[model samples]
Target: MTHILAKYLVDARYEDLPANVRKEGVRTLMNWVGVAVGGSREDPVKRSIAALRPFSGPPQASLLGRTERFDIMNAAFINGVSSHIFDYDDTHLKTIIHPAGPVASAILAFSEYHPVSGKDFLNALVLGVETECRIGNAVYPNHYDVGWHITGTCGVFGSAAAIGKLLGLSEQRMVWALGLAASQPVGLRESFGSMNKSFNPGRAATNGIFAALLAAQDYTSSDGMIEAKRGWANTISTKQDYREITEGLGQRYESLLNTYKPFACGIVIHPAIDAAIQLRNQYHLTPDMIARVDLRVHPLVIELTGKKTPQIGLEGKFSIYHSVAVALIDGAAGEKQYSDQAVRDPRTVALREKVTATIDPAIQPQQVDMTITLKDGRKLHKFIEHAIGSQEVPMTDQQLETKFEGLTDGILSQAATRVLMDRCWQVESLPSAAAIAQAAVPQG
Candidate 1:
């Protein structure tokens, strides 16, 4: 049977890919690198890397943003963790799958052990993203509504497929890889407010890479793992819409639909940030001028971004109140806004107390919207038909580069930053994957 996944992974043709698809792939790579760099400074990622010191494996791979090296799996784990440390990684808004976390993390780590050209990097990344987004779209509202982390659940399959392509797996063997990946799909939304959140993708990166390696050796599994009644698609997911995956196949690329992020918080908070930023500029209001801020949103937003009095950095990302306050006060929402000190600031806490969300049952049926009322007798309201990065207004190349530089600034010297950016832009061109692995390591 030609399943949706098989149609894309096995039968899809790459002849008609649009030009911008390739450019977007590069943009996502840039964004992911920036996220990984920014995330390296996170306390959880630091602790995780520091904890790995006892393993003492050969330094065969590079962990982006850190000089520490480990086996490919460990390296992928650390890099993947760092990418989402701040929840700043790129996203495919439609699926809510953070594509770069699993795809870029696994591919970069695998490249460290296996050399492939920059063109190949682009191709492999493009394919991985297509696989991920398509699967995400297929089972989306149902899968997510039923409670599953798509990035961690579908991510391993996509990451494994990408790596298998680089390893030149036969179509049959690729199917085996997909089956192996399906058996390992894992991630949970319950961990969103804590470090368990980032750990999902990192673990998927490790599992995905390992799966591909095993499949390349002619490892075997049931070919129908994705569609079997008791298989991955139905067991762990709510429903299987196979056409979404098989419809385009290779005739169209899924990567083009990927969205880049402009902020470093949960995707649900973006609409509120946009609304708040607008109010900040139009009202010319400083933090002192604001009396109260009220917002309306979908229940998911409240569930995900509803941390009322977040006490820590990670918690701040999930706090709609804190995120809105940061956008209005700081005029920007970046890693610094989520710093430990930022959360404890009295002013931010006070602002959080004033902000409250209305669970409008009407809008809950279709989308998320937010309205803010200010003390100066001005009311600013916006119906966020779509969030900023929902494949609606993607971050431009210049914007992405600016973000990358900012994240890697002190961590990587100007010259090194330039080198890494160039390497990522032309990743598939490298004669040795070792070049990227070595380049990603932080300098002492």
Candidate 2:
């Protein structure tokens, strides 16, 4: 399985990808850039930049939304953190891995160091996403159930595969890189809610770059570290399906499964939020309609995001009650809806208290059953079979542009944001992939 993946990573070409797959890569890149820049001024990002600035080796790569640059690896780490700070980055729903942060962050940072063309960059992005997601598929329920953050645990491989491809690592060196990455899995579910949640993906990005660089120098690691009896699979998960990693390498692209978040919070709550907003808008129901919202959701929704009253923005992300309340009242669930102020708002709190969720084994993770009971004795219900951002109902290009605008509105000048958006959409044609990162910086 390792050898097969290495060959695919090393030999895959941009032209080999189907047009839609190539386009999906662009979508992932666009969404990643928006989230990274949007979260650049976040507390976690600010503190990380402040702490690392003095010791940063060299300004070799640009930070996505800020003017500061750092050595390639450090830049990868910071950008990865920023991309995931809002919990709004793209996700491979099968394993719930945020596909771009570790892979794209490392590759784009490496692009600055190596001058990679846009076509090559896109190819690397697709391969990297595929690598992590496939590995994620193999160990998902077990690995995730055991409290490992699947993105950080699996993302290092994506990062290493991407950077290794760019560095032209041989099959043997690529195997070594994967082995090294395997030895450095990151993030625990217990860390969710703190800045460390975002740190996992960022550190995975840096770890991958570290592994690849060392492998390029002929640093040795056990080649079977991923699937060996005592290797990552057996050590980290009780069940292993090697076919998930080895099957349909070039034919099936996991990057195609990538889903972007329309709401800025956790994906598990998206279905309920979608249903709530739809009901609010459809009936022109205001929060004052004197209603209680009832939700029947998948068991994981309550397990992962059942917070009844979230005191902070990060905690708000884990609160399905808060998500539905804000969605119903504001008709949106963007970052503002999950803000510290929003979480503490009296109106939000009142509505949130009226919202209740119960686990329904019949409901799918992407589906929700919502009932809004009003003072007028009118009961309106919506059963969302699939959330808007799910693969079944993806956001349109126009919708994605709207999201990007919202994220950048107050941060980047209109002209700068427009330029950055254009660069991201047409990234495959650029002479250098770094242009997108350069354009993302806020203009004074």
Candidate 3:
């Protein structure tokens, strides 16, 4: 199984990708850059920079959106954290794995170290996304149900594969790199509301770089570490279908199924936010006009995002009620909507309290049935069969560009932000991947 994967990775050419697949890779990169830059100045990112600066090695790579540079590995870690700080990165809807943080973060840093061309960088990215999402498909709900953050758990494999490909590791060493990655999954659901939640992907990216670098120097690990008895699959999950990883090597790309978050919160809360925002716009509703708001959603919605009253911004990401309240109150659910100020706002708090949710097993995870009752006894309803950012209804390129602009508006000058965004879109034609990284850093 390991050798099969390595051979495919070794031989998969950029020309082999479908046009849409290649385009999606650029889209993924563009989105990752935006979120990383947007979250660059967050409190968690600031603390991480302070904590790691004392131990950082030689400055070899850029930290997207910031002026500081660090060793490639530390740069990868910091960039990964920044990209995911808002919880607004790309997701493989099937497994809810945020794919880019670990994979892109690692390779962009590696590109700085190795001088990878944009073509090769893009190829490695598509392959890395495929690697993690396939593995994610094999163990999805089971692995996730057991308290693992699927992104950080499976992302190490993606990171290792992408970096290993860039390092030109032979099949034997690629196996070792993956073996090292398998032994180092880095997240738990218990960390969701804390800074540790973002740490998982960052650590995964750093670990993958470490794994690939070691393997490039002839490091050896169990070749069958992923499938061996008591190995990753058997130990971490009760269900393992190897076909998910090996059945469709290059023909069917799972990276194409990647979805970006329009809202800066958990996927489970998107439906409610979508419905609420639509209702708010339709009726121009205010908190005082709302009597009661009710939501019927999947059981997982309540399990994953049922926080009725979030005390802080991070906690707000996991709150279905808070998301809907803010979306209705503000007509948008961006990072600003989930800020500590928004969470503690008297109007938002009151609206959130008025909002109630019930688990409806029949409702799809990406769908919500929302009903709003007004003070004068008018009832409004909106059923979101497929939320805005779902695979069924994905965000468009122009919309993604808008999202990018929104993220970088205050951080970079308008002209500089546009230049950075254009570079990301044209990444495949660029002479070097380092150019994109360089453009991402704040300019004087």
Q: Taking the candidates one at a time, how many backbone clashes does each contain?
A: 8, 0, 0
User: Which 10 consecutive residues of model 2 have the lowest summed lDDT?
Assistant: 1-10
Instruction: Estimate, for each residue in 30-78, the C-alpha lDDT of model 2 and write its tens digit.
Output: 9999999999989999999999999999889999888898999899999
Candidate 2 lDDT at 173 equals 97
Two-way lDDT contest, 1 vs 3, winner: 3
Error of 1 at 413 (Å): 1.3
Query: For model 1, how does the per-residue alpha-carbon lDDT over 1-444 read when each residue is reduced to its tens digit?
Result: 223464456543334456688788888887888788778867778788778868847777887778777887888888899998888987777788999899888988888777767777777778888887787777887888777888998888778888887888777788888888888977888888788889988988888888889988999888887778887878877778878777757667667777777788888788888877877887787877777787777787787777888899889999989998888888888888998899899988887787888887676422556556666677667676666666656676778788888899888999888898888777646666457657767777
- Count residue pairs with overlapping backbones in model 1: 8
Whose lDDT is higher: candidate 1's or candidate 2's? 2
Range of the 10 consecutive residues with the lowest summed lDDT in candidate 3: 1-10
Q: Can you give the TM-score per candidate against the true fold?
A: 0.94, 0.99, 0.99
Cα RMSD (Å) per model? 2.2, 0.9, 0.8
Q: Candidate 2: which stretches are off by over 4 Å? A: none
Query: Per-model C-alpha lDDT, please?
Result: 0.79, 0.92, 0.92
Pairs in clash, predicted candidate 1: 12-250, 13-250, 117-428, 117-429, 118-427, 118-428, 118-429, 119-428
